[model samples]
Target chain A: MLIWNRAKILYIKKINWHLCLIFAAISSQPILTSMTWKQVFSSSIGRKLTMGLTGIFLITFLIVHMGINACMWAAVYFKDDHGEMFNKAANFMGSMVVIRIIEFGLFFFIFLHIIQGYMLTVYNRSKRAVGYAVDYGSKGSKWYSRSMGLLGTLILLFLIIHWLHFWIPSRFTGVEEVEYNGVKMHNMFALMQTTFQQLWVVILYVLGCISLGYHLAHGFQSAFKTIGVHNKRYQTMLTGLGYAFAIVVPFVFAMMPITMYLGWVK
Target chain B: MEHYNMSLHLKVWRQNNSRDKGHFENYKVDGISSEMSFLEMFDVLNERLITEGKEPIAFDHDCREGICGMCSMYINGKPHGPWKSNTVCQLHMRAYKDGDTIVVEPWRANAFPVIKDLMVDRSAFDRIVQAGGYISVNTGNAVDGNSLPIEKDKADASFAAAMCIGCGACVAACKNSSAMLFLSAKVAHLALLPQGEPERKKRVVSMVAQMDKEGFGACTNTGACEATCPKDISLSNIARLNQEYLIASLTADK
Candidate 1:
C-alpha cells in the first residue's frame, strides 16, 4: 500500500510538470511571434498599417502644435500681456514630464513614418519592373496622391531645418530665457520672432507649410479610410472635415511666420 | 450607319511562356473598321498571323460582351484602355485615331505571372476566393428567398459589390499592385447578407490572410483602382473590408 501511494504521487508530479511546460509555451507564443521582425514589418499590409497609425499620430501632433503656436495671436487681442500667454503655454509644454515623454514618442513615430514611406515608395516602383510607354499623368488619380513620396521628402527637409532653428537650441543648448513669476522658461516666442526676421527663413517656413497642407489633404481622410471608416455619411463628413482641417491648420502655421516677419503681431 | 476604316500600328507584348523572355513585336493591321471592338481587332491580327504560319499572340477572352472578366489587356499606360468604366472587349476602336500607335501588354504584377503573351495566371484570385469566399450552409431544400428580409440600402450596396467580375484590373492599375479593392468587394458582398452571418468572422479573417499570403502589395488608397475599375466598384468597399477585418481581429475566437 505504501509503495502504491508513492508511485501515484510521483506520476501526478510528472503530469503536472508536463502541463506546466505546455502552459508556459502557450503563454509565451505571443512574445515569440512579436519578436519576429519579418512577420511585423515585411508584409505589405503590415507596412501600410504602420504608415496609417503613424500618420494619424502626426496629424494629432500637428493640431496640438498649431494650438500652441496660435497663442502668438493672443497678444494681438490682449496687447497688455505682450505675448505673455504664448510664453507661458510654451513653458508649460516644455516642462511637463508627460508631454516630454510623448515628445520622445512623437520623434520615434516620425522616424518610423519616414522610413516606412520610403520603403513603400521603393516597393511600389519595383512592382512595375518596366515603365509604361505612354504617360497617364493625373488621369488615374489626383497628382498630390501620387506625389506623396515627394511631398513627404520635402516636409522631412523642412522639419530638419525647423528643428535646428528651434528644438535643438531649446532642448540641448542655452537659449534666451525669461523668468516669468520666478519660473525661468525658454523664450520660444522671442526665438520665433528672431528666426522669422530672415526673408529666406520665412520663405522656407511658408513653403514647408504648403507641403504639409498638401500632405494632410490626402493623408487625413486616407488614414480614416485605411482603418476602415467607410460609412457613406461618415465618409462625406470626414472628407469635409479633412479638407477644412488640411487648409486651416497649415494656413494658420504659415501665417504665423508671415505675421512675425511683417511685425504685425508685435 | 456609316463605318470608317483606319490603318493602325500595334506594339504587342509576346512571351512564349512564363520562362521565356518577352519583347514588343510590332505588327501593322490596315483597313481596320472603327466599329470593331478592341478584341475584334486583335482577332483580325491573330487571323492574319495564323495565315502567315507565325505563332499567334495568345490572349484570354470569353463572353466577348464583357461579363466574363477574362479579357485583360494593358493598352497604352492604362488598364483595359483609356476609357472610363470600359473593358477591353467593350472598348471600340473608334476611340483611336487613324495613325495611332497602340502599345498593348499583359497585366504586370509579381502575383500575376505571365502565362503567355497577354494571358496572366490570375489563379491567385481563385485561391483568394477559395480561402473563404463562401458562406457555410448545409445543402438541403432551397431556403425561401423571402425568408431573409434584407434592408434595401444594404442589399443595394451588396449588389454593387457583387458586380465585381474578378477582373484583375484593380491590381494592374494600383501603383503597389494591391488587391484591396478586389478582396473588399468579395467581403462586402457576403457580409451584407444575413445568410453570411454564421461564417462572417471567419470569412474576413481567412480571406485577408489569404490575400496577404499571395504576395500582393498594400493599398495606399490612391483611387487609381476606383478610377480604372471597369465595374465602377467604389473605394468604399475597401473601407468596409477594413472595418470587417478590424472587427474580426478583435472579436473572433481565432
Candidate 2:
C-alpha cells in the first residue's frame, strides 16, 4: 500500500504541478486518515451517512438499469425489429473495459449497502432489549416507513433471484449469441423472453418491483434528507419528487416483465 | 363532558434496579375519577400499595404540566400514553374506559437504563447536551434581543426546534431507539440563530459524535419521533442536522 501510494504520487507529479499539490493536500486530511473501520461501522451517525451515500448510488443504478432495458421497446416500436436495439445496448455495456471496472465499484457499493443495512438492523434491535407488551401498531409512524428492514430484505431476495435469472447468465455462463447489424452480442432480449414465458418468474418480478417501489418511496427522500436537505420548501419538493420516482420507476420496471410475458415486446 | 368514576386494572412494571429483570405487577383501583390525571391515578395505586404493607412503584415526574419532560412513561405501548402531543402527567383518566387495563413501562433505550420500576437514568441526554448544545457567551450584561436582526420564519423555526424538553419520548417511540430527533432538535435550536453562527459547524459535529458515543441508534425516517413528541417537534430538524453534519464533515479545516 505504501509503494502504491508513492507510485501514485509520482504519477500525479507527471500529470501537473497544481494537481500534485491538491492530491497531497487531500491525502493529508485527518478525517480520512483518522477514521477506522470500527468507528465507521459502530458510529450511528456514520453508519446512517453511509446508508445515505450508498442508497443514492443504488437509486442511480436503477435508472440506468431501467433505461438500458427500455431499449427493447425502442427496438420494437421505432425500428420494427425485435431485440436488435437491446442486444446492441447490452453488448456495448458488457464489452466496455471502463464499464467493467465501474462494475466492481457497483458491486462493492451494493454489498456495503446490504451489509451495513443488516448490521444496523441487528444493532438497532439491541437498543430496545425488551419491547413494549401492549402492541400499538402504526399509530406514531407509517407502517412502511418503519418496515424498511423488511422491505430491504425483500429487495435483497429479489436481487438474488434477478442475479440468478439474468446477471449470472450474461456475465458467467454465456447466453445464446445473435448478430445484429454485423455485431455479435448475447441475445439477452431473447433470453428474457424465454424466462418471462414462465408465469412464476413474471409474478416474482412484479413482486420484486412492488418491494422496490416501497423501498424507494422511503429511501429516495431519505437519502437527500440524510445528506442535509432538511428545509421545509426543498424537503417538500424532494418528497413529492421521490414518491413520483418511486411509483414511476418501479412501474416501468414491472412493465418490462409484463410486456414480455404478454408477448407485447417480442 | 360528563365526569364519572371508574374501576381500572393496572399492569405496572416493577424492577428493583437496572440489573433486575422486571415483571408487571397487577393492581386494581376502584372509584377513580375521570377528572384525575394519570399520575394521580398512580398516586391512588401507590397509596393503596403502602397501606397494604407493599412497596410503592417508583417513577419520575416534576412540573406535571408537561414542560419539564421528567415523566417518562410508555403507557399502552406509547411514550406518554394515548393523547396526541401530551405528557403522561398531562394525560387525564377520561382517555380510558372503566375496567381498562393499562400497561406502563419506562423509556427502553440502552442509553436510558431503568433505575427502578418506571424510572430510568436519563443523564445520557445531559451528556449529549453538554457535548455542544449551547452557544459560548461572555459573562456580561444580557445582549439586547432587538439588536439581532433575524428573519421571522427562521426564528419561528428555531423556536420550534428549541421547544425540545430533553425528553426521551423520541427514543421511546423509535423502533431503533434513535436520538436523532432529540439531537437534531438541539443542533437546530442553536444553529438557526446568529449567536450560534460562530460554533455552528462544531456544535453539530460534536453533538452527533456524542450522540453516537452514547449508544443511541440511527434515525430511519420513521416519523414516530415527531408524532409522539409532546412538544410536536418536527422530523425536519433531523433532516437539518443531517445536512449540517454533512457540511461539517466535508469542510472541517482540521
Record all residue pairs in model 1 with backbone atoms less than 3 Å apart, i.e. clashing.
none
| Candidate no. 1 TM-score | 0.89
Model 1 DockQ class: acceptable
Listed per model in order, the count of residue pairs whose N, CA or C atoms clash below 3 Å is: 0, 1
All candidates' lDDT scores? 0.84, 0.85
Quote the positional error of residue B246 for candidate 2 in Å.
1.4
Report the C-alpha lDDT of model 2 over B1-254, residue by residue, as the tens digit.
89999999889999999899999988889999999999999999899889999999998999999899899999988999999999999999999999998889888889899999999988788667655676655545877889989999889999999999877999999999899999999999888998888878767777777787788888998898999999999998988888787677666665
Residue-level lDDT for A245 in candidate 2 = 97
Q: Which ten residues in a row have the lowest lDDT in candidate 2 chain A?
A: A25-34
**Model 2's TM-score against the true structure:** 0.90
Write model 1 residue lDDT over A1-266, tens digit each, in one string: 44334433544575553333233322321121111344444555557767888999999999999999899998788877677889999888999999999999999999999999999888777765655555456778888888899999999999999999999998998689888889888888888888999999999999999999999889889888877799889999998998899899999999999999999887
What value of lDDT does candidate 2 attain over all alpha carbons?
A: 0.85
Q: What is the Å distance of residue A167 in model 1 from its true position?
A: 0.9
Worst 10 residues of 1 chain A by lDDT: A26-35
